[model samples]
Target chain A: MMKILVVDDEPDVRTLFEQRFRREIRSGALAFSFAYSGEEALGYLHEHHSEVVLILSDINMPGMSGLELLRRVRTEPAPPPPPRVMMITAYGDETSRTQALALGADDFLTKPVDFAALKEKLLALPSA
Target chain B: MSALYNFDLLVAGPLCMLIVLALRRFFNLAERLPRWNQALSWVWVPAVLGFGITAAFRYRSTLLDDAYMLWVYAVVVLTLLLLWNYRPARLALLALAPLLLHRLVRFGLDLGNLRLLAPYASLFKGWGNFANLWLIGLVLVARSQKRLLAKEQQQRQQEEQAHQLIATQNAELERLVAERSATLTQQAASLQQALEELQLTQNQLIQAEKMASLGELTAGIAHEIQNPLNFVNNFAEVSAELLEELAEEQAKPSPDTELELELLGDLTQNLQKITQHGQRAASIVRGMLEHSRASTGERSLTDLNALCDEYLRLAYHGLRAKDKAFNATLHTDLAPVLPLVEAVSQDLGRVLLNLLTNAFYAVRQRQQQGGEPGYAPTVQVRTRRVGDEVEVQVQDNGTGIAEAVRQKIFQPFFTTKPTGEGTGLGLSLAHDIIVQGHGGDLTVASQEGRGTTFTVRLPIYSPE
Candidate 1:
C-alpha cells in the first residue's frame, strides 16, 4: 500500500481527502495520514520516514510554510527513493511556482485543485 | 550883489545837485553810481555852502545881507543828503517839524523883523526847493517797496509748483507699486496651483503602482480560496453518492431496513445542504478571480448590457457583505438587442465593477449622512448601443461631487473618501482599462448635493 501524508491548516481538508479517496482506501491500494500543520507533518515524517511515499501540503499556513517543509523533506536522509513533495498554494503566480520548484518541490498545485487530474498524476507514480 | 557872483553861484550850485540826483534816480544807471552816498553827501554840503556865501556877497557886498537865508538853504540840502538810504522824504519831514517849531519861536522873538528875513529867504527859493526834494524822495521809496514785493511773490510761486510736482510723482509711484503687487500675488497663486497639481500626479502614480501589485495579490487569493471550495464541493458530492449507495443497499430487503432508511435520509439532507452552500462559495470565488485576473489586452465580442447588469449585482452584494447595514436599490435599464462590443470582457467587467462599486458607495454615504425624508439611496445602471459605439452609464442619487472638484474627479488617486478607506485609484485604472486599452471614452456629469453619472463609451471596432 502507498502511504500519503496530507498537510493543511484547515481541518475540513483532511476529511475531504479521506472522503474523496475512500474507495482506494477500502481497496487497500492507498492509505492517507493527515497533519494539521507543517511542524506536525515534519514530526510524522520523523517517525515514519520510509513508509510515507508522498506528501501533499498547502503553502500558506501558520507555522512553517509548505516551502520550508519541502526544503526540510528534500534534505532529510531517508530510505532509497525519498518521498515526493507536492506544494499547494492559493496563489497561482509564476513567482510562487518558480520559488516552490527552486526549493525542491516535485509538483506545484493551485487552490480548487483538480482532483481528477491529481488522481491520474498520483496513480502514475512508480510503486512505493 | 555882483552880477558874476549872482549868475554863476546862484544857478551853478542847484544845477550840480539836480544833475547828481537825476543820475541816481532815472535812466537805469543807478547800478553805475557809487555806493558812497554818505561821502557824496559831505562833498555836496561844502560846495553848496561856499556857493551860498558867494551868492550872499553878490546880493549885498557890504555887511553880510541874506547870509542867514543862504545858511538855512545849505543846511536843508545837507540834511537831505545825509539821510540818502533811509528814505530821505521821512527824514526831511522829521526835520521840517523841528524847523517849523524854531521858526514859530523866532517869529515870537522878532515879529517886526519877519518882513526883512522873508526877503533874504526869497533869494534862496526856500519852501519851493524843499517841496521838490520831498516829492522825489517819496517816488524812490515807492519803487523800492514794489521791487521787494515782486521778488517775494515769484519765490512763493516757485515753491508751490515744486510741491505740486512732487505730489503728482508720489501718486504715480503708488499706482505702479499697487499694480506690481497685484501681479506678483497672481503669479504666486498660479505657482501654488501648479505645485499642488504636481503633488497630485505623484500620488496617482504611486496609487497606480499599488493597484498593479494588488492585482497580482488578488490572483493569489483567488487560487487559494478556490482549492478549499473545490474540495468542499467535491467532498459533499462524494458523500451524497456514498449515501445513495447505502440507500440502495438498505432497500435490498435487509434486516432493520426501516431504521437504516431514516438515518440515511437525514444524512442525505445534510449532504445536500453542504453541496448547495459549497457551490455558492465557489461562485463567489470565481467572481473574484474574474476581477483579479491579469489584463491580456485581448478583444472579444461581448454582450455589454448583460455584462453590466451582472457586475452591478455582484458589486452591490459585495458591498453588502462588507457592510451589513448598507442598503440601496439598484435600477438597471439595459437595452435589449444591444450589439456586442469588441473588447476584453474581463477588463470590461472590472470597469463595470469599479463604476458600480463607486455608485453604491456614493448612495451608501448619503444614507449614512441621514438624507432627506423619502430620499431613497439608489444606483442606476444603463447600457445602450448608438451608431458604432456601445455606452454604459452608472449613476448614483447620493452625495454628488462639488463643482470645484468636478474636473479633478477623473484624475488618478483623486478620491474624496477618507484615508485607509480608499486608495483613490479605482477610477484612474478603470479609465486606463476602458479608454487607453480599449480605445474608448469615459466621462462624468454631476451636480453637487444632487447626483452623479459616469458614462463609458466603447467603440464597436477597437482601432487597435
Candidate 2:
C-alpha cells in the first residue's frame, strides 16, 4: 500500500488534490492523507512515518515551510530516510524549484494542477 | 603775384597747429610739454618775434617800411582770427598790440604825424635800422620753421592711429570667422547624433509592433491547435484502455491478435507522445503569444495578485516542462487588500509574463553553470498598496545580473540567451506597455549573486 500526504495552506487546493485522487483511494490502489500546514505535516510524519510513501507539499504555508520540511526530511538519520516528496505550488518560481530540489525533493509540480499528468507520475513511482 | 604777407604765412602754421593742439594737444597747449618746449622760449612767442622781422625788413625803404608794418599787422590779425575760432574774437584782436607798438616806435623815431610817418617811417637809412631789421628777419624764419615742425608731428600721429584701428578690425574679423566655423561644426555633430538616436528608436518601435502582432497570431494558433490535440490525447488514452479490455476478454491463442495488440500499443504510445509534445508546443506558443500580444482596449478593475499567479504558473510550467529535474520553492505574499488597479488586462498580463519568464530563465542559467543541481531556485511575487499605486513585484533569488548590463536590460531585442532563443524584447515590450501604453512605472532593483526585483506601479485608475 502506498500512502500520499498532501499539504497546502489553501483548503481548496488540498481538496482539489484529494478529489482528483479520491477514486484511486476507494479502489485501494493508493491511500491519501492531508495536512494544512508544515507543522501538521511534520506531526503526521512523526506518527505515521512508516505508512507514508510519497509526500506532496505546497511551498507557501504558515508555521514552518515546504522547503524547511524537505530539508529536515533529508537530514533524518533513518535508513532510506523518508518517502519521496514532491512540492505542489500555485506559485512556481525558479528559486522555489532549485531550493526544493536541493533539499532533496524528488519532483516539483506547479498549479493549476495537471491531474492527468500527475496521476501518471504517481503510478510510475516504485513500489516499496 | 607771389607777393605774400609773412605774418599771414607764419600764422597759418600756428593757427592750424592750434586745431591739432585743441583736438589732441599737439603742443604744450595742454598742461604738460616734453624736453623741446621745456627750457626753451614759448614756441609761439619765438614765431611771433620772427614774424616781426619781416616787418623790420620793409624798413629799408620808407615807403616799404610803412606798407610792411601795416600789412604785417593785418596778416597777424587774420591768423589770430582763426586761432580764436574756439576762444573769444575780442581776445584774438589782441594781435593789434603789435600794430600799436610798431606805430609808437615809428613816431618816436621821427617826429611826424600819420602821413609823414607813413612815407619816412623809422625803417630806413641807418645801421641801427638795418640791425633791427636783420634781427626781425631771423625771428620770422625761426617761427616759421617751428610751425612746420608742429604740423609734421600732428600728421605722424594721425597715421599711427589709422594703422592701429585697421589692425584691431582685422583681428576681430578673424575671431568672428573662427567662432562661426566652430558653431557650425557643433551643430552638425548634434544633428547627426539626434538622427542616429531617432533611427534606433524607430527600429525598436517597429520591432515591438511586429512582435505584438506575431504574439497575437501565435496565441490564436496555439489555442486553435489546443482543441484538436486535446481530442487526440483523450481518444488515444481511451483507445489504449479499450484495447487492454479486449486483450483480457479474448484469452485465445491467436498470432494475428498478438500482432494486432502490438501495433495498437505502438500507435497508442506514439499518440501519447504526440499529445505530450503537442501540449508543450502549444504552451510555448501561448507563452510567446502572451508576452508579445498587446492588451485589447478593454479596461477593468484588475486584481494584480491573480494576474501574478496566472503568469507565475505559466512560467513555472514552461520551465518545468523543459527540465523535469528542476524543482524550485515558490513564495507569494499577496496583500489581500491590494487596491484594484484599473488596467488593460491583456497588457498587464504580458508584462507579468515577461518578468516571470525571465526570472525562470535567469535561474536556469545559474543551474546550467553547474553551481548547484538541486538548489531550489526561489521566486517571490508580492503585491502591495503603496501610496495611490498598486505595486506588483516579482522577485527571484537567481543569478543576479551584472551591473553593466542592468542599464541596457530593457532595450528591445537585447537578450542574454543564446542565439535563436531570446529576442530580448521581453523587458522592452514590458516597459512600453507599462510606461507608454498603460501610463504606469516599471523599475528594477538587483544585487549581483543575490537576486533581481522587478516592480510594476499601476495607478488605481489607469488613465486613458
Candidate 3:
C-alpha cells in the first residue's frame, strides 16, 4: 500500500482528505498519516521516512511553512530515493509557487485542492 | 615829482624792500599765496628801489641840511619795525601813525620862520609824504591777498565733506541690498522644506488609515466568512464520501440505475457550487488582508472603476459582519471608459473603504434615530476620469454633518461617533493618502440634515 503524509494547520483538512480518498483507503490501495504542522510532519518523517511515499503540505501554516518542509525533505539523508513533496497554498500565489518549485517541490496545488487531479498525480508515483 | 625824488626816497626803497621780506617771512606768504599773486610783487620791488636810489644820490646834500629830512628817515624806519606788531587792519593803522607825526613836526618848522631852513624843509616834507602813501597801498594789497586765501580753504573743506557723505550712503545701501537678498533666499528654502514635510505627513496618515481599516475588517471577515467556509468544506467532504458509497453500490448487484444516477448528479452539482462559492469567499478575505500588509510603494496600472466597485461591495459586506441587521441600498455609477492608472492600489483601496464606512455609518445613525418620514438609507459610489485625473465620490443621504463639524471632519482625532467606538483617525488618514501620497485632492460638500458627499481626485500618473 502507498503511504501518504498530509500536513496542515486546519484540523478539518484531515477529515476532508480522508473523505476524498475513502474508496482507495478502504480497498487497501493507500494509507494516510496526518500532521498539524511542519514540525509534527518532520517528527513523523524522522521515524517513518521509509514508509512515507509522498508528503502533501499547505504553504501557510502556524510554524514552519510548506516551502521549508519541502527543503528539509529534499535534503534529508534518508534511504535511497526520498519521498516526493507537493506544496499547497491558499491563494494560488505565483511567488510562492515559483519559490516552492525552486526549493525542489515536485508539484504545486491551490485550495480548495482538486482531489481528482491530485489522485491522478498520486497514482503516477513509482511506489503506487 | 623831481623835487620829491632825493636821498631820503632812495633810502625809502631799501626800507620798503625790508618790510616786504619781513612780512613774507613772518606771515608765511609763499604757502598762502595764490598762483597769480606770487609773481605780482617780484618785478615791482626791484624797479621802485632802482629809481629812488639813483635820484637820492643826486639831491643828497639839499635833503640832509633840512630838519624835515630827519623826519622822513624816521617815518620809513618806524613803519618797517611796526609791521611785525599788527595784523592786516592794525598794520594799516600803524601806516597812518607816521603821517600824523609828520604833520605835527611840520607845524613847528613853519612857526620858527627860519628863511634858510624854509626851502630845504619843503623838499623833506614832500619825501615824507610820498613814503606815507606807499606804506598805505602795501597794507591794502596784503589785506586783499589774505581774504582770497581764506575763501579757497573753505571750498576745499566743503568738497571733502561731500565725498565722505557719499561713501557712507553707498555702504548703507549695499548693506540693505545684501540683507534683503539673504532673507528672500532663506524664506524660499524654508517654504520648500515645509512642503516636503507636509507630503511626508500625508503619506503617514494614509498608512495609518490603512491599518485602522484593516483592524476593523479583520474581525468582521473572520466572523462573517468562517460559517460559510465551514458549510462549503463540510458538505464537499460528505459528498465525496457519498460518491464513494455510490460507486460501491453500483459495483453490487442490480441497482435502480436511472434514479440513483439522477440523485448522484444532483448531489455532485450542489457540492461543486458550494465549493466554488467557498473559494470565492476565501479569495475575498485574502484581498481584505492584503490591504493591511506593508506595501512596496511601487505603482502598477490598475482599473480605477473596477477597484471602486469591488471596494464598495467589500465595505458593505464588512459592515454586515459587525451589525447583522444593518442593510442599505448600494448604488454604483462606474465610468465605462476609465483608463488604467499607475497607482498604489492597496493605499487607494483603503481610502475608498474609509469613505464608504463613514457613509454607511452616517445612514445607520439616521436609521437608529428614526426621524424624518420616508427616509431611505442609501450610499452611492461613482468614478470617472476627468482629464489627467481619476475622481471617486462617496455620498450618503443620512445624518448630514453640521457646517461647523464638517470643517473639522478631516482633522486627525475628530469624530462624530461615540467614544469607545472610533479612533477618530479614519477621514484624516484618507485625506492624507489622496492628497499627499498620490498628489490628489480630497474634499467634502454637505448641507446639514440633508446629505454629505466626499470626493477624491487622484492623478493618473505619478512622476518619479
- Say what the interface RMSD of candidate 3 is: 14.4
The list of candidate 1 runs beyond 4 A from truth reads A60-62, A89-110, A123-128, B1-135, B191-217, B243-247, B255-464
Clash pairs, candidate 3, are B6-B56, B7-B56
Question: Per-residue lDDT of B117-206 in model 2, one digit per residue for the tens?
Answer: 433634433434564565456445545554665567678777878887888888898899899989999999999999999899867765
- Highest lDDT scorer: 3
TM-score of 1: 0.44
lDDT of 1 by residue, B395-441 (tens): 99978888888777768778888876666677887888887888899
Q: Write the per-residue lDDT of candidate 2 for residues A1-128, one digit (tens) a residue.
A: 68888887555344344435545765788887888877788888888856789999877543366877787777866445468899965444677788787778889887545668989998888872
Clashes counted in candidate 3 amount to 2
When summed lDDT is taken over every stretch of 10 residues in candidate 1 chain B, the lowest stretch is B60-69
Q: Which stretches of candidate 2 lie over 4 Å from their true place?
A: A1-31, A35-47, A53-128, B1-294, B372-374, B462-464
In every candidate, how many clashes are there? 5, 26, 2
- Looking at model 1, residue A49 earns an lDDT score of 57
- Model 2 C-alpha RMSD to native: 14.1
The segments of candidate 3 whose C-alpha lies over 4 angstroms from its true place after superposition are A1-128, B1-143, B206-216, B220-228, B256-267, B282-309, B317-355, B367-397, B401-447, B450-464
Each model's DockQ?
A: 0.10, 0.05, 0.05
lDDT of each: 0.68, 0.65, 0.71
Docking quality band of candidate 3, CAPRI definitions: incorrect
